[model samples]
Target: MSYVLITGASSGLGKVFAQEYAALGANLILVARSEEKLLTLSAELRDKYNIDVRTLMQDLSLQESAEKVFAFCNREKLTVETLVNNAGFGLSGAFDSMPLEHLEKMIILHNLTLMKLTYLFLPDMKRRNRGSVLNVSSITAFQGIPYNAVYAATKAFILTFSESIREELRHYGIKVCSLCPGLTETAIFDKAGIDPYQTLMPIGPPEPVVRAAINGLEKNKNIIIPGLINKILIHGGRLLPRSLMLKLGIVLGRNKKAFLQNSC
Candidate 1:
């Protein structure tokens, strides 16, 4: 049976993706660093959906993690019909003040690992002439976010890469979509040290975001931006001057402490 392989399946959007796929009666291969969470989610999905759920615990920020995940799927005879590259983290602070190691890890997890996984899995999909890839980018991808520079840049790469591949793989009947959700109900805000309430933007739930992404992927959309407000923000931002957008990004991107400090 074919499986939908999802990275960072332990929590947030990744976890929701796993559940949504399982609900669609698809088998799943969930990869994440948290073994306990993965196992728990795997068990829950299998029991509720009566679909096979396999879990792999690996920190995707590591260099060789994608290769290892590919190898495991091969060894298990798991035919991945869909691959969701959703493993990522963000660090918010002045670029110079952030830890170098964390920044490097973020780059690896968001870009390198995602790219490697796509490269590893595309050959199989090509041979089969059928597959889908959902890359979880962010609304931040549309611009240069000041406090969240690296993360935004990584997401931008995903957006462009997904669009490029969508065109290239169309002949092979493979779908490539980039999911760019705005502020959603997820742990990313806390992890990135940004308080969602402080941002003054409406924080959406994961269900609708994942739903739109799956629907968009099914239709082979190049990009899926979830919320209506998010759509407005993205489209309207394009009409503004780059300098003005950059200034706005500084206010919107900063954490509570940074925003307060700047306000004073």
Candidate 2:
């Protein structure tokens, strides 16, 4: 059977996606940095669904991890019918105070490594003429998010990149979708150093995001915004002038903004 490969499968939307796919009777290959969580999830899914569930514990923040994941897929003969590039985290507080190593890993995980994995697997999926790719971006991707400069920028790259390639893959019958969910209840907040309350406003759980993302993949929608309020916020931000948006973002993520600016 074809398999759904999900990075960041240890928790949040990634974990939800794994469960959703298994519910749909799809086999899975999960990847994450948390070996304990990954192993637990792998066993849980296998036991729950009686589907073949394999896992790889690798830090996607590392340069070689993408290559390793790709190689594993090839060796296992796992036809990656779906790819969920969902592994990422954010840092809050000030940019300057954050370790340079952490910043580098952020870029590597959010941008380069994700792009690398996509590029590696996409060609084979296209040649086979059947597959879906989901890049988990965020509503923060719309414009410059003050505190989340690099993370937003990386997501923006993912958003545009996925849309452009979605058009290209039309003929190949491969669908590429970018899921731009707003603030969800996840560990991303703790990682980013922002309080969950600091998130724009009230938001739904990651479950909707995962469900909508899966639906978007199946329908071949180029982009999926899981919540109506988030869709509104993203659109509203675009309608406003950049200066206003930036100012507002600073208020929302002051620690991040000041840190980045000071570091620069």
Best by TM-score: 1
Please, what are the lDDT tens digits per residue for candidate 1 over residues 1-105? 799999999999999999999999999999998999999999999999999999998999999999999999999999999999998886787788989999999
User: Candidate 2 on 1-264: residue-level lDDT in tens?
Assistant: 689999999988899999999999899999998989988988888998899998998989998889999999999998898999999997755566778898889889988888899899988988898888999998777888665677778889889988898888889998899999877888877766677564445567888888888888889887899888777777778889997777667644554445355446
lDDT of each: 0.90, 0.84
TM, every model:
0.96, 0.92
Which residue pairs in model 2 clash with each other?
90-192, 91-192, 92-192, 95-259
lDDT of 2: 0.84
